[model samples]
Target: MPQNQPTNKIQNPETSVPKTPEMNERDFLNDMLTTEKYMTGSYNVALNEASNQTLYQDLATIFKETQDCQRNLYNLMFKNGWYAVDQAEQPKVQNAYQQFSGYKNQLPYAVQ
Candidate 1:
């Protein structure tokens, strides 16, 4: 039986405690998928804060590619039953859409 060790001394139900032995595919994919998420976020930030138009476009393209990669990884994980995704409630989704669309056309932010 695999031992389920909590990441910290106190087990947090909301967070995952990765359990993979012999460096399994689930472990590799989870780590790569997670790291790609961070990379995508960094690319998005660079795109938003880029003072140079060329740099901004380059980052935007890279961000899109990273996003596609993340999606593919996620799909694979999901298909293999290695990833658990919780669907958002329709009301919650509607509320978020209303909130965000309220700021439509607003500049992402003032460039520093």
Candidate 2:
């Protein structure tokens, strides 16, 4: 509780589990989340390289579903405090925005 410490962390109470070698709910969910992430990445590659229109559409649908599942798993883990992320500082965010703001002008097409 100091001014120098960051205050933007958002988390829920973490569920307690045994520390033994046995797998727990958190472990299973974490595994599944990792699998989903990998699947989504593979699907993205397939979608990009798809040659047939029909296959591309099908892959796109499956990609969206896989992405959604990944998001849900992430949300569940975050809600259970299994996942933690630091919020970006306002000044740093503004700095990044300012740094990127001029790049839009370099684009070939007009943006709005």
RMSD of each: 9.6, 2.5
Each model's TM-score, in the order given?
Answer: 0.62, 0.88
- After superposition, candidate 2 runs with Cα above 4 Å error: 1-8
Q: CA lDDT of 4 in candidate 2?
A: 91
Q: lDDT per residue, candidate 2, 4-50, as tens digits?
A: 97678777889887787999989999999999999999999999999
lDDT of 1 by residue, 43-89 (tens): 98888789999888888888999999999998877767676655566
After the best TM-score superposition of candidate 2, give how far the Cα of residue 33 lies from its true spot, in angstroms: 0.7
Model 2: which ten-residue window has the lowest total lDDT?
103-112
Query: What is model 2's C-alpha RMSD?
Result: 2.5
lDDT values for all models: 0.77, 0.91
TM-score, model 2 to reference? 0.88
Which stretches in model 1 have alpha-carbon errors above 4 Å?
1-20, 88-112
Can you give the lDDT of residue 75 in candidate 1?
Answer: 82
